[model samples]
Target: MNLGIVGQAVGLFAVTNIDDVVVLALFFAQGAGRRHAARNITVGQYVGFAAIVAVAVTAAFGATFLPERVVPYLGLLPLAIGVRAAVRVWRHRGRGGQEEDERTGPGGPRLLEVAAVTFANGGDNIGVYVPVFATAGIVGMSSYVVVFLALLALWIAAGRYFATRPVVARALSRWGHLLLPMVLIGIGVVILVDGGAFGL
Candidate 1:
């Protein structure tokens, strides 16, 4: 039992750094004012990712069946997400009125909306995560959760920082609309390759 715990901890720590970086990059690219919406996003990300990990772990235990072929197809998800993000960037680049409304109600962004956006942003991460959790065994969950929360806090802080700085904010806001699509596409290609879509 001790060995199992230690092994899980080590595996989690190993993966956490990479995962956190990816998460941070994704949220950062989404633009400023994300902090206000980030609370819900963080919670949703945690829950959604936790569920995926749980499922992956369970499937590893042979409690459920997911085909080997299907795993590779997971790459398509990120690819699609990337394409959509690129499109959004293109659309927003030309249109001034299409900016996301800042008028989220007192309750903030809707919980489901937050969850949906987080999940969408997280699509590429999921492709990376599902395989990692599957191989890392059952011990990685606690460490993964802790690292995820830590990264979330950092992401929120970074968002706030970028949103507040006038010069930096304006520059980022301008380029942000251009950058998001490229980032998404890059993530998608990476995911596709990782998933063995190109035959490893």
Candidate 2:
């Protein structure tokens, strides 16, 4: 149980997940008027992140069938999601704000939907996690999981705090429709480039 390894795990997770905070903040703002918004997001994030950890740990073990190059293509999931969101916003612009609000109501974003987006957004983490888990023994991996889960709670709180702020929430509500999709697309491109999927 090296403290250094724990520190490294925390650092790596925090650094890679910094962008998630922004995304999560937008989710919070989107669902601000919804009941169980925080709970839904918390559950969704855990489910989504658990899938990521499962994949990374499995790869760390003996499942080397999936190539490192192919992992980058997973970015397409988020890219598609972003494009869909952008289209929805565009269509809603012609329909009117009330229609959009009714469609995406207080109970709009379901747990599975958020989970899907979170999983998609988190696809890039596989690259970092696989290499880290390869070197980490069972205890080290366990430590990483514990630290990550704890930090995840903090991350949720931060997003909720931002969403609760009147000015911040209003700003996000106003501009998030335009920005979130672009951000997701950008994340996908970064993942693809970083992974050198097409040798580019």
List the RMSD of every prediction in angstroms.
5.4, 2.6
Model 1 lDDT tens row, 52-147: 555555655655544555555555554565576677566656557546564233333334433443444354444455656566556664555455
Poorly placed runs, candidate 2 (over 4 Å) = 94-106, 196-200
**lDDT (Cα, 0-100) at 149 in candidate 2:** 82
Model 2 accuracy (lDDT, Cα): 0.78
- Tell me each candidate's TM-score: 0.60, 0.84
lDDT of 2 by residue, 1-200 (tens): 67988799789988978878887887787676667777888899889888888888888886965576677777776677778878877878876667545634557445876677777677878778987888888889888888888888898898778877889878887787677778777877777777776776
Q: Give the C-alpha lDDT of model 1.
A: 0.52
Candidate models: Cα lDDT each? 0.52, 0.78
Error of 2 at 72 (Å): 1.3
lDDT of 1 at 34: 45
